[model samples]
Target: MEKIATIGLDIAKSVFQVHGVDAAGEVVVRKRLSRARVIPFFAKLPRCLVGIEACSNSHHWARELIALGHDVRLMPAQYAKPYVKRGKNDAADAEAICEAVSALWLKKTRKVPLQPRKFLDFCWYQVNFLENNISISGG
Candidate 1:
């Protein structure tokens, strides 16, 4: 089997947990990073495959990571769920993501295409505007 380095990221609104494995499938690093620091932290890492769950804001981070010269793969959260052990937490989720990506069956996992930032941002702004308008009318 070909060896490859991979980093699994469990992203959230503010904090993100990362699990990194080397070519030998040995864990090289595991840490929690804040949203503000995610890009900068990965930017310093050696080029490797970065796995993330396909959820809100995932494509944004994936694009940023790819722009920094790292390969990024987006896996569905359901596909990654089976890898989780008894304990469920951010660190566990990150480790599960890494394990899932390394599995031979990972080829079957669905890959989420990256979303355009401009389009996503525009949608968010529209939603916020609608919410604000509703609040004003209700008040």
Candidate 2:
């Protein structure tokens, strides 16, 4: 079996799709894993780069993967969308993310360094904005 150099993971509520490629960009692994098995699966593989579409749960997963020694990158969904060559599906999306993450363009953008303080600030700002809007609307 070829050693996986990069992996794209499309995570959802229950199931997750994985797309892996070797250093030469050839697909090596494509499969679906349940939420409970994600960590265990990655734990067994040699450390590799993992790409995940930016979403609510992405940061959580990114931290988890990073803890296991894999380099994890979070690319905005829009960035990954352009790489999708087929219909919209978890598998296809995962493949797209893999390609997008490994593309040269990805190197040009600033990597998302997940920070708890930043996330908290954003959440607090949202809550304050919503509260102010509700009071003004009397709703």
Candidate 3:
């Protein structure tokens, strides 16, 4: 089988875990990064396949990474769950992402449409603001 470089990103609010494998299926890079540094990190990597779990903020990251010239694939978390071996941790999750991508079982995985980050951010901010106002009024 032809080998292809792949990266799996386990994203969160502030930190993210990344797992990478080369064409030969050899682990290339595995590390954790903060949200602030994730883009810059990928920006420095050579273009390759990137896999991320389809979740709350995934579309935003997917769009950003795709724009960086990498082939990005978003796999629903359910599809990735089985790949988890023993423990449930960032490293393990990252590895699962890598395995799921390289194995190509992801073709059937559902893909979520990308949403505008700014719009989501605005919605979240508005909710928070309303909550604060309600609290101030003892409601």
Top model by TM-score, which number?
2
User: lDDT (CA) for every model shown?
Assistant: 0.83, 0.89, 0.83
lDDT of 1 at 106: 83
Error of 2 at 98 (Å): 0.1
What residue runs in model 3 are displaced by over 4 Å at the alpha carbon? 1-4, 110-139
Candidate 1 off by > 4 Å: 1-4, 108-139
Provide the lowest-lDDT 10-residue window in model 3. Answer: 105-114
Q: Which whole-number lDDT from 0 to 100 does residue 30 have in model 2?
A: 98
What is the descending TM-score order? 2, 1, 3
Which pairs, if any, clash in model 3?
Answer: none
Q: Summarize candidate 3's per-residue lDDT along 1-139 as a digit string, tens digits.
A: 2233899999888889998988888888888999889989888887898889888988888889888888888887887788999799999999998888767546765444455577989889889989888444556
Q: Tens-digit lDDT track for model 1 on 29-86?
A: 8889999989888878878888888888887888888788887888888878999985
Number of colliding residue pairs in each model: 0, 0, 0
Candidate 3 TM-score over all chains jointly:
0.75
Cα RMSD for candidates in order: 8.0, 7.0, 8.3
Q: Once model 1 is optimally superposed onto the true structure by TM-score, how far is the C-alpha of residue 33 displaced, in angstroms?
A: 0.5
